[model samples]
Target: MDIRVVACDIFGTTVDWYTGVAAQVAALLPEVDPGEFAARWRGEYAPSMDRVRTGEREWAYLDTLHRESLDGLLAGRPVDEPTRDRLVRAWHTLPAWPDSVPGLTRISAAHTTAALSNGGFALLTNLVKKAGLPFDCVLSAELAQAYKPDAAVYHRAAALLDVEPSQILMVAAHKWDLDGARAAGLRTAFVHRPREKGPRQEADRPEDVTADLHATDFEDLAGQLGSR
Candidate 1:
């Protein structure tokens, strides 16, 4: 299919959220090694998502999840609530991948492009403004009260864009998100974010469908997706 729009996930997919979060965590905790703190902080991602995903608790945005996860990571540290609040707010100010702006700009010129991330509308909006992401729209799983890897979130993207799922391309660094999108009937593209796990972090060695196309980042995505 000739894709008319590209819907991308925000965290790790478009921006280096791990690096950004680690950077903030480092600055927030001068006593702790930023790199180690970042690794520990990110380590809680899945279990936290599981709480919302399995209906064990009400669905919450990534912001809340991050906070909940952070509290556990704090381990009775002397850090004040104010600094913690600032750290929680760091999710809103991620520095985009170097390829993010230029690639999205180039892609947007020819295709309708937007963020279809698990990040809430407000959170994603603030990030876009802070990072200068050239997204035409921001769609979130938050709108569906669910997270990615859920078919509902994938379908919501189509309804919000008022386009058929087949016409919208779901691009991500995670195969699980792409698999969900594919199962929900959207085409998929892979943007390799080898650093999503930080230095020497293991990348998913294989993908479900071998990704319709493979690229290193948004810029690579744009180049392969060019003039299509």
Candidate 2:
């Protein structure tokens, strides 16, 4: 493990987006099933980004895509425009998982820790500040004008950090993200978040993913990486 930088996926890997968004939805629309609403909203994430990635749509920040997806998901619902906007912005303040801050703090002591996410710079910065995540720097798909799983995003991070892809460890909970990073020649680590989608999530588990390292959470990941 000759990693100099630890590039982390922000959404499900470090922060609990599911819990954060679902809680906001439940607060604003008690009649709607918050869990289902959250899932549906998140399900739109990839396709919305894919539209831009494939050149079907021009480059749009993730915040724009999130708002668009929210509008579609809230159609026929009784939410007002202002309330909808607030709910959409909920993503900007997701809470870090219990071990996220500590783990990242420890890892940062040993390596340059950064956010390598699809989130826009503003959104990721806000989330990091609100969650108290200890990232040395923030890098986003928006910066590369491309989303993750695309080679451009990974390459951009390596370039910005002035490191070889092989010297950066891309840590994420999504196998597809790890696969993309690996394809781009970066080392990969999969951290399992069993309830990332919801309480009974049938999401990808560590056993289903192949990476340089697989761990139960950020704390476990820090330990495995020999971070003190």
Candidate 3:
């Protein structure tokens, strides 16, 4: 695909949120099933963003939403504030997938690569730094005061990068994200992240979606894009 910028989704696309958050949750509540708790916490993601999307709530960063979701999930569990805060901060330190850094490094040498994620500025910044992700810039939904699946967020990323939607390729593991980018006139790529939520997460596989490109992982993506 001919593209000027390659914008990637952060959480599930590049980092293993399930494993990362589950480890933190396990540390906080050893008795709980960490993987299940992580899944439950992530289940609140879209709904929480929907509150802001529909104007039922003010614009809140993903970090704030994460904390709120954590509280709701842990209701009546007797968790202290400090521990809860650390658990929420866990989102900021997700480890990149095995292929993420090398793939991004390869692709960035040939094309401008940036993170276009629902994560807020501080959160994405910390993630990139902690994971050593090679993004040319970090663009967040917070910048547009909107979340993904909203056309505004996609358009805003293109605007900030000074590129046309057609010239920008949106790469994501979630079909919904690619669908939103496609609707907004951007080229799309789907990366399979089968274990994003957990080992049984069947949703992120490539069979269900159509995009300009599809790959099993970031390394495959780099190869397909002809990036060294």
lDDT values of the candidates? 0.84, 0.92, 0.91
| Candidate 1 positional error at 119, Å | 1.0
Give TM-scores for every candidate, taking all chains together and pairing residue i with residue i. Answer: 0.93, 0.97, 0.97
lDDT of 3 by residue, 1-228 (tens): 569999999988999999999999888889899999999899899899999989999999898999999999888988899999999899999999999999999999999999999999989988999999999999999899999989999999989989899999999999889999999999999998878889755656678898999988888999999988
True-structure lDDT of candidate 3: 0.91
Compose the digit string of candidate 1's lDDT tens values, residues 1-228: 779889988888888887898889878889987767777777787788878888899998788888888889887888888898999888888889898999999999899998998888999989988889999988888888898888889888898878898998999888878888998999988888777878756655444446777777887788888632
In the predicted model 2, the residue pairs found to clash are none
**Model 2: per-residue lDDT, tens digit, 111-163?**
99999999999999889988999999999898999999999999999999999
Which segments of candidate 2 are over 4 A away from where they belong? none
Residue 140, model 1: lDDT of 82
Which regions of candidate 3 fall more than 4 Å away from where they truly are? Answer: none
